[model samples]
Target: MPPMVVLSFLDAPVVTGPARGLIHLARALPPEVRLHVAILRGRGAGPVPPLDEMSDGALTVHEIQERGPYDPSILARAVAIAWRTGARVVQSHSYKPHLIAMAVRAARRVPWVGHHHGWTAENDKVKRYHRIDAWSLPRADRVVAVAQSARDIVVHEGVRPDRVVVIPNAVDARDLSTPMTREEARAKLGIPEGEFVAAVVGRLSHEKGQDLALRALAQARAQGAQVTFALAGDGPDRAMLEALSRELDLGLAVRFLGHQKLVGVVYKACDMLVMPSRSEAMPNALLEAMTLGLPVVATRVGGVPEVADDGEMAWIVEPESVESLARAVVDCVARPEERARRVAQARSRAAERHDPARRAERYLDLYSALGVR
Candidate 1:
């Protein structure tokens, strides 16, 4: 069988949560299925040297150094690579890749699978991309959404419901389950002993609602909750969020650990994980924390309910509401027994739904259905 082409044309390097998820997927594929990864070149983006170390000769990385918006040369390079590799299936992971795949199908008639992680029209430029995705999606042989919420958005864009598949993001069950007590992790990270730590692990932005987390943390502290909020990712909104934290007088109560490469350690250090995203579609950070058996307080938005299962495995609160978020945080901190129960339930469900190898097997099945033997 020809190798499968997996396109990851991210604007930046593989530092973000989504990029890490893709790495996990690539490393998890069966050895018999050779994989070609096509990635855009940008800050932190380059030849993935670690794939050589990790994949046991099953993966190849291509760095496409195309640098302009709406550039057809990038698509040309992707098509040339696929044709040269005799790729039986071309799988795309974002709007750029999807558009490129659409063009490639016209040229080569190769089976195309478009993968949607999530969608956010945060501005006019993003709205344009959404339009582009809607325009090109019908050309794909299959469309994979990381969550049902994402699938619903695609279906609303007029694609046939059957064309879309929901594939929840997966986590490597090994690294997260490594034996590390919260105390040991906190010591390693220099967090004060006995301080309640709630971590928000994502890019600092309005859409991610890190600001909401800050407000909630402040409110919880005011109520004598004794909890500190740690933000584990950085973005353009970092300065703004820092300003808000100061305005709320959250001195020393908030820590900004920018771009955590060892995210599992961060999860282990925290007493609980909190996701205050105003919008989301199956956050991999939440999945990873849950798989590691961490208690969680997440906003009931997007696929969180699906992951949380109506509060069975997490304390779910309404999005963009600081009062509800504060309440959940305070309750989670005060009730250790309840948190432990939720953590156990979360681990069981995460193992059942988000195992990395199982996710790879599902993709293999999808590849077979696409007529790649």
Candidate 2:
């Protein structure tokens, strides 16, 4: 029997969450499955490390060079790759990829799977793209949502509830096990010894609520908590969030690390992980934090509560509420024993339920159900 060929499309200029998740899933998939990744590189985009290198040669990556964002030939190019690879199923990871997959299906009668990771309406441009995605998703044979909230959003967008399946995001526990101790990571990152550090590891965007995190940090400080904050990702709201941090007079206590490639070190350097997102769809950072054994304080939005139980695996707080966020941070900092207990439970839960291999099996099952032998 020939191996099942699954060709996936991604429009990643850099290694984003969906890109990383696809790579992890590809690596964990059984030997009977061959996963091929095609990344669309637009003109003037900065150098992105080869996906093959990032995947450590686990995937066959094809870089599709595009003239610009609106390149009409991209669809033909993607269709050619699908035919060449003999792909039984075509999966798409983002809005642009979703469009490409729809076109590919028109050209070839292969099964299409649209993977929805939720939308971040940071700007008008992004909202427009999301609208396009909503229009294209219902055409897919199956729509895989990273969270139940995401599944609901797609169902509301006219996709049949039966066609939408909820598949939570996952992480490989072995991949996150850092050899560096907490003190070593802190020293390497120049965080002073004995200071309580809370790290927020996501893009610095409005949806991520970095501004709210700043206010929460200020309030936590005012309430006598000596916790230092490290914001470890960069995005559109960097300048605004930086200015707000300065305006709040949080001078040296907050460190904007600006997109650490070795994010595991950032995870290891911090005493806890803080996710202050106003919205989320099973954030990869939360799963990574849980797997890495960092105590989490996340907002109760989207699929967050589905990943971590409040007061059991993590401390859940209300979204967009600076007061609630501040109180959770202060209280989390005060209770060391509770942090340890929750971290242990979170790690165990992550290992058991969110394992990458288990997630890969679920995808394989989905593929089999789609008639991909």
| Best model number under TM-score | 2
> Which ten contiguous residues of candidate 1 have the minimum total lDDT?
48-57
Candidate 1 lDDT tens digits, 3-39: 4554444433554545556667778886566677776
| C-alpha positional error of residue 153 in candidate 2 after TM-score superposition, expressed in Å | 0.6
- What is the alpha-carbon lDDT of model 1 when measured against the actual structure? 0.79
TM-score of 1: 0.92
Give the distance in Å from residue 58's predicted Cα in candidate 1 to where it truly belongs.
Answer: 4.0
Q: lDDT for each of the candidates?
A: 0.79, 0.89
Residue range 313-362, candidate 2, lDDT tens digits: 99999999999999999999999999999999999989888888888988
For residue 199, model 1's alpha carbon misses the true position, in angstroms, by 0.7
